[model samples]
Every structure is written in C-alpha cells, then in structure tokens.
Target: MTQTPPEDAPTDAQSTFSGTREVDPRYALDEASLGVWLTANVEGYAGPLTVRQFKGGQSNPTYELSTPGRTYVLRRKPPGTLLPSAHAVDREFTVISALHAQGYPVAKPWALCTDDGVIGSMFYVMDKVEGRVLWDLKLPGMAPAERRAVYNAQVDTLAALHRFDPAAIGLGDYGKPGNYFERQVGRWTKQYRASEIDPIPAMDRLIDFLPATLPPEGPTRIVHGDFRLDNMILAPDQAQVRAVLDWELSTLGDPLADFSYLLIAWAIPGSLRNGLAGADLKALGIPSVEEVVARYSEKTGAPAPSNLDWLFAYNLFRLAAICQGIAGRVRDGTAASPQAKSMAAQVPALAEGAWSFAKKAGA
Candidate 1:
C-alpha cells in the first residue's frame, strides 16, 4: 500500500547539504554563489558552475553540479526547519565512507563539508551513479517469465547485505548494534506520537505488542535502512543489483527489521494498499509471508517468522508514522505530491493492515 516516506529519512535544512533531497522550496544558485561554496569545500575545483536540484528524494534536496571536467552529485539537508537528527550530513558521509571498505555496494565518495558558511548548511559530493531505479514496474505488465526471476533477485541482493559484518567494513563505531527490537519499537513509537495529529488506536496496540510478544535476538549488520526496489540500481538489462543507494538512515541493527520493511514494500496479495504505481502484488509472485519466512530461514538459519503478525503489524504502523511525518511537511507547504498526500491519508487503512497481519499470523 502507498504509505509515508521511510523512517531514517533526513528532512532538515542542515541535512539537505549531505547530498540527498526532500521537499523544499526552489532556490536558484548563481555562479558566484556556487563558486564560493565549491571552492571552499570541494578540492581541485576550478570554478563554480551550474547546479540543478535533483529529483527522486523524499527526505533531503539533492543537486547535480557540472564542472569544467567532471560531474558530481551533491546532497544537502532541506532548507527550512528540521528535527534534531536531520542535520547529520557529516555522519551520513562518514558512515557511508566507512562501509565502503567492507564489501557493501555503495557509490564512490569525493568530499564532505560541515562548514555552514559555504551553502547555508553542510553538504557532500560523490561520483554520479547511473542505472535503473526499478521502482514503478507493475507485475501485470511484465513478461511472465521475468517475474519470478526479478523477485528472487531482489531477495538475494538483500541477503547479500546481511552477509556483511559491520566491523569487517570499518563500521565498528558507525552505529551501536545491540537492542534492536526495543529500539525500533521505541523509535517508531516516538515518531508516531510526535507526528500524530490524531490518535490511531491500532498503532498504539501494535507498538505495545511488538516488544513484549516478539523474540529478542538478532545479529547486527549494516542495514540499508531504506532497501527496496527503487533504492537499488541494477545493471542495464541485467537482474543483478549494482549499487544500493540511500544509506542515510543505515545503522548496525537487526537485519530482520530491514527484511520486514522489504516484505511490506511488496504488494500484499488481495490487499487494498497494493503497490502505488500499479505493481500488482499477485502478478510478481510476491512471496507469501510464509514463503518469505522460509527463504530467510534457509538463508540466515535464523528463527522462522514466529511473530509474523507482530512484524507485519509493526511494519505498517512504522510506515504509517513515516507517512504522517511527510504529511506534516505537506501541511507546511514543503512537499508536493498528490500520491504523497493520498498515502498520508491511508495511514489509518495501513494501520488496519498492521492489525490484520498481526492477527492472521497468530502474532
């Protein structure tokens, strides 16, 4: 179902500079202004040139810069106000840089600037990556032969991330690893409370049941934080995932939490919140909850999806809370999307799914 933007999304002004983009006012950058910022931060830059706001982000505002001999992607926090953690461009850059050493798929980093004087906030630059975003494809429109292959490929790439050890990649201090389940419940519950304009009863219940009912152990790994079809760029005409983008919210935590988010990203069979751009949940052989549980079981040798219902419910609640945050931005006049607004409206319905998934799975 269409839901709010994912959690761990950076939505503040200071966060805007780190090379991601979200809802923000259109601001034109003059040559001199651009030159000042570029020279101050980026090295070996001859002059400041044209900068265009990059689309395709729901958190920070991203831009592309054209220099005399090269191109770069610039991500920065949103221009207006933001939350406490939103201004973490330095942290985002540092974490991603560290993770690069460890077998994780990521873009090559160029520079990070925390000085606010250059561009009104912090920012970073990386080599531009090109590939298919792979988000809006509908299963019904796909050739039948390609459906199962694509779906299976998605799962395996995710499994690859879980295969990496955080410390092996020099991410030992990137983020703390313990207390995954309780932290998730607490973090999302707080987001729900802060972003709530009205009370959603199912959310409260899902929040309460999650920690108490679910098991308490999982291995720590570098969670892509926003892993989904759209976030992964694939090779041209190949099913293999190339680089996984958007590690801003990534941290050392339980891989299953990220896995559950991926599960929810797929269209649930016969559900009203089916994928947003017409990706029929039924056509893609979108793995059933049981199948997903089994696959992860085989791969990780972890516990079977025992609290399937709890995970399903909690995931939706977390999604709804995230949507509410974006909806708040819309109210503030920063974001513009009919679908985003519509998704925010669906929080209650998504919460309903949360409740149903919880009960159906005997959670």
Candidate 2:
C-alpha cells in the first residue's frame, strides 16, 4: 500500500515542526505525492496547483487547494496510527452530501476517490465554503448591533442540527444508539487505563459515576459529534451561519449530547482552557448556556432537561478524556507537540470541573 506524506507529522525533538506523534504503517500523502493521486482521480484542469493547509481541529488535516481556475478542499482520513472504524471516510461523505441536499448550508462534494491505488486510502474533494471559521472569535470587538444577532445565529445553527431528521433523510443507520452513555463511559475508561502512565484519581471516580448520572432519558437526533464556532462558517455579509463544517464525528444519536458538548465549552469559554494562552474566549461571542438551552427549547420544542448538571459534568469529562487521549498519543510517540507534554496536567482541573458541574447538573 502507498502512504500519504505527513506534512504536519511531529519529529522527535526536531528544532521546529509537529505531528500528532503516533506511528502507523499507514502513510499520508504530502502535496507532491498527492498531486499524483489527484491526477488519477480528480479530472478538470491539470498542472501545478497551489495548496495551503488549514490548521485547527482535533482530527483530520484539511487544505485549501487552488488551481488556475478552480478552488477545492480535500478531506481525507488522518494518516499514521488510528483506531478502527473511527475514521469512516464514506460515512463522512454520505452525511455531508445528505445535509447539502437538505438545504443545510454545507460545502458540496464533487468527487470521492476510494481506490487504494490513488493515495493508499479513500479521499474526496469538495468545494471550499467561503467565510471565516474563528475558533476564538472576539465578541468584545464586534459592533454591538450585530453581536446579539450573531449569537442568536450561532444558537439558531445548533437548533437547526437538532431540527434535522435522519430517518426523513434516508440515513436511518447512521450510528448505533445502544447504551450511548454507558458506551462512552466504557470507552473513556479504557482510554484512561491505556494512558495511565501517571495518576488521575478523580478521573477514575468520575468514570465510575457517569453511567448512573446520565440524563434520565435519551433524546435521539443527528449529533454533530464535535460542534463549535471554528467548524462553522459565518457568512461575511450576514449574521447567519453560512455552513456547518466538520461532520466527521457526526452520527445518529442523542442530539442532546452535542448540545451538552457545546454548553460545556460555551458556559465557560476560557474556563475550560485552564490558562492556555492564545485563547481569547470572549471574541467568539458564545451565548450564555441559558440562552443556548432556551433557544434550543424554543426552536426544537424540547425543553432543556431539568437536570442539566449531570450533562455538564459528562461533557467536561468527555473533553478531558479526549485531551487525555491526545496526551497518550503524545507519550506513545504518535503526537509530536511539545504542548502535549503539558496536556496531561489538564485532567485534574477537568475532573474537578466535572464534579463541580455534577453538583449543579441536576439544575
């Protein structure tokens, strides 16, 4: 099998350059190498093209590709080491294509190359959506007139995802819904065990508490596994959301899980980062958790759950667990960021926050 080049792969203590830092026999295609794959699959105008990689996101590496007369974004599974079925290339394309047809703002995919001969794995091309995807949007800097509108727009966008019906769209089998919270608890617990090179007592205890503390009932809808301002494109001309980006983790399950994730980050923007620099949480202008829950209630007709504390704690635990996974790969030589060295330190506060939310979760 051929391999894709690791443009962002982290080298061992190399002066400067970083990677997710895991080693897998599976390879990623670099620009020069990917050009060969493009030649065989994507046909339009050929010749040298310009490609610039977009940074951000916990998974997948995306790039803005430009030829003399064309513009596109390439989406491929992250190369190097990874877990099985976790990066379903076809599932990603299918959901996005379905969402596009449903009038949900999403970049339209033009082609998919599944031939292993092409680039060692399946990859696809889609038209790149225009606008800014600011992770740390500055709320204080915006004109006051548009601030509330933008915040409402963000709320409206999440509300729209909850509005989506997978059955109506012919995606009934998108994701399994059996034991949703239990499975999450089990999975993270396993990840913690696999990465427990150091001690994390509270994480262990929180894992034990999750299954029992889950929301009283599960509400199913299309979940955007990871939803945030950075993954969304705000139309430059309007306060409305132009498109929802990054559906790789999307599935058919508890839509509330998604809402919970957003609320976790939304309620305390900088609070979650634990003194991480370059995170100006206020610029994004995330609505208050109450605003978000209330708007979602108004639009979706499902009132926010009476016991929100449990959900909040669960969300914090999941985020911290995810970072723990990142820290594990860093230690295992899969992640190459020096920042990974400090990431494991985040667990204690993260666990504490989880417990804190637990206290208020039923509210």
Candidate 3:
C-alpha cells in the first residue's frame, strides 16, 4: 500500500508502511559480511549490494537487498531476546519455498543463512516482489469495481491455500492436526502471559472463557495465520495478488480460524488495521462478510462456518495478545518499527472487542 504522501498531511498507514526506510539502527547488519555471504550462498549472486529496511512492523526484521541486476528481500530474527517459538525466519523460508514450488503466489526463496555470525541472527533471502502492498482497506484511489475485484481475488487466493493438502506439499508435520482452537487458545494464552506488560481485565476474561468454550475442530489445512489485504502484494496495474508476504504465524490449523481472522476487518473499525466496520460497503464495492464467506465456501467445497461469534472472539483475543507482545518489546527496547508503541496501545481496545464478541457467543 505504498502511496506518495501529501506534503501537508500527517503520515497514514499507506504512507508509513508503503515503502522501505533506512535500516533502523537497532536492526542494522554488516552489509559487507552479508554481501559476501550472498555471493557464496545465493545462486547467480552479484555483489555491490545495497540494503534498506521495509517500514512494516514485521516481527521478523525484513530488509531489501539490491544489486546491479536484481533485488532480493531478506527476513531475519530480530536481535535481543524474543518470545519462545517466535520470529522463525527459517519456517517462513521453508513454507514459502514449498508454496513457490507449487506455483503459489509467493516470492521465490533463494537461500537460508543459519549462521548467526553473518547477520547477528538467522536470516533468509527471497526474490523481491514488485507490486503494490495495500494498507488502506477503503482503497482510496481505486475504482469501485476494482475494489470488488481485489477483494474477490483475496478470497480466492486464501481458499486456494486452504484447499492444499499439507502432506502432499511436504508439510504434514508442520504442526499438530486437530484440536486447532484448543491448542491455539493455549498457545496464545501462554504467549500473552509471557509478554504481559499490564493486566488487561478483558484479556483475563478471554483467557479463561475461550479455552472452556472451544469450537468444534474442522479438518486441518494450511492456515495463513495473518492473512489480510495488507499482507498481500497486488499486481502493479491489476487487482490480482502477486505474492502473499509475512508467514511468521502460518501453520497446519483450522482453515476457518484463518478465514475468520480476515473477517475481523468487517467487525473492527477502519482506524484499526484499516478495517471496514463503519464503511459503506456498497458505495466502496467491498463485499459483506456473508459474501466473502459464501465465496470461500464455494471455492473450498466446505460448509460456511458456524459459531462465528466465538471464532471472532478468539481471533480478537489472539490479536490483543500479539499486540501485548509488541508492548513487551517496546518495554524491552527491542521494538522493530517506530509504530510499535502505537500498536501496543491497541491491546486494551482489542481485548474489549474480543469480550464483546464473547458475550455474543453466550459467554
């Protein structure tokens, strides 16, 4: 969602996260050492590399590597202590490498560097995708029809991913199958507690409520845990997705949980992660939640999900925990993006929203 910023306006998400910035001093790496490693490890490698960091608040620090012939993107574990099982750049590379081989829309992974000496942490490099990474949900300058098409493409892409057989793709053991909600509740609860900066009462309520009222588990499939518009790169002149980025949370899980996470945009307001709650969907050409779900069901040959309220509640609670983790990072002085503080501020509101949905689910 990179767009040129108006000279007089304050920075918005589109401007703030649209392009690359000078590497943050905290996440800086030795360019000479990285270049040498790339030359040795990457196929058809070239030197005279230039590096810059992407502006998004990716838990894994991502850098753009440019050379005379081509550009590559590198994702690495952030320096300093990280939460257990977090920032798995190797997993990201593994998943993307598998998906790319299947002709899925993901950047082609080139090489993974496990040696911490090269970059202060493990990192992986992939082809730099050239496309638009949209941030604003309303899609300010896009025509109404184009907006509808883009949303359809997103739904279709996700359904395709969900339809893939993990075992066939060499990822059957990527994560435990079945009991997806139960395991996720436990996992995120532990993560939330580990990263708790302040006691959020709503979060506490959810931590207790979600586990007790877990939804029925569906068939296991590849779940892009953070699937959303902002995470995808759209073709420069078309509405189609070119590549889906950010795989830190992806695993074999309930497809419905992954799909419901995208539906969160319709429940939350536009100010939060560019949601569509209060927007005029007809005027904007955005699909309603029902339409989105129906399309997904049609594509995957699965029934539309039931117990959505509980699912939304769980997703929102999980999101709050994630934000709280960022708050912990801020407290630890290892936050990657300048926007981490503001994202941390959203935890309370997210928790509150989760509780509201819990109430709807008869919690």
Off by over 4 Å in 1: 1-24, 27-31, 43-48, 137-142, 266-303, 336-339, 361-363
Each model's total of backbone clashes: 23, 21, 2
The TM-score measured for candidate 2 stands at 0.81
lDDT of 2 by residue, 204-320 (tens): 778767876665556668888777655678887778788887787678877777777766554453422211123433454445567678888898888777766787788778767
Whole-model lDDT, model 3: 0.87
Compute the lDDT of residue 255 as modeled in candidate 1: 85
Listed in order, each prediction's TM-score against the native is: 0.81, 0.81, 0.96
lDDT of 1 at 125: 83
Which structure is stronger by lDDT: 2 or 3?
A: 3
Q: Which candidate, 1 or 3, would have the higher lDDT against the true structure?
A: 3
Residue by residue across 1-363, what tens digits does model 3's lDDT show? 111111222336688677899999999999989988998999998978889999875478889999999999999999999999988888888899889999999999999999999989999999999999887788988889999999999999999999999999999989897898899999999999999977889999999899999887799999888988989999999988999999989889999998998898898775444678888999989999999999999999999988899989999898888888887988999878777777778788889999999999998
Model 3 off-target regions past 4 Å?
1-11, 271-273
**Backbone clash tally (model 1):** 23
